[model samples]
Target: MFRSLCTTALLVPLLIVSTTASANPEVDRMFAEQDANRDGVIDQAQARAEATRVFRALDVNRDDERVIAELDPQIASGSPGGDGFPPDIHVVLRQATMQLRDVDGDGRITRAELQQAFVDGLLKADHDGDGKITRAKLIRMHQGVVSPAR
Candidate 1:
């Protein structure tokens, strides 16, 4: 359910953060969008909530299942370089979700795997020991200005 969502949450934000400048206007926009409380950081609870929301949105069939076809609409409706879900992102999302969340390797992501993936992704990205990930922190991590805690 949330495996793809977790992968998307990690990849999309990291990919966007990687392309941002030190000032990172893009990061600011992304933070604004995801940081529901306008608190300047995305905590684990917020990340989980977002991951769930993203999962629900992509579950087009409403069967508690997610397949590659479910992403077609979002991909088809996306514009080049627009601030919306794009085709390439979905492609990567599909592959990454399969790779990371298919724990039994049965070619499907189960609910347990989704929850684990979200926790793993959060732990990997939360480098500040603050239990939160801020846009500035992400940009700095990508820019090699900040290293993960040992």
Candidate 2:
């Protein structure tokens, strides 16, 4: 009984944190964009496509690669004119995107790495073991409630 109480105490905060952390409209928009078919879920292929789109957008020089300088401006813009996400939300997504796409850890994002990162993200968001991620699952992931899909 004591152990159960302690476990419940620990889990309650986590549940609250998870839900609150994911309650951003901009973040929701970004994830929703990945649902290419508009079926309300993001699959691996869709993730790959979105990642590719982001990679291209950030690769301003069109050198087929990205550096911190290239990606920084977009984040710094703070969703200027509502064309992007606010700083708070954009920062997280940008960091995650870079982490996933920078395979060599050399501070550069490549096309191949970008593709893989989205696939990784898809797996991470697919809670309920459903092989697909709904908005709720994405929110749960943001809250840190579930581990990525296998």
lDDT of 2 by residue, 82-131 (tens): 35676677677567546645888988878787677566655665666666
State the lDDT of candidate 1 residue by residue for 100-130, as single tens digits. Answer: 6567777655545555655555555566677
The runs of at least 3 residues in candidate 1 whose Cα sits more than 4 Å from the true structure, single-residue gaps closed, are: 1-10, 13-23, 74-93, 110-119, 144-150
- Model 2 worst lDDT window (10 residues): 4-13
Top model number, TM-score: 2
lDDT of each: 0.58, 0.60
How many steric overlaps does candidate 2 have?
A: 2
State the lDDT at 47 in candidate 1. 64
What pairs collide in candidate 1? none
Lowest summed lDDT across 10 adjacent residues in model 1 is found at: 75-84
lDDT of 2 at 77: 44
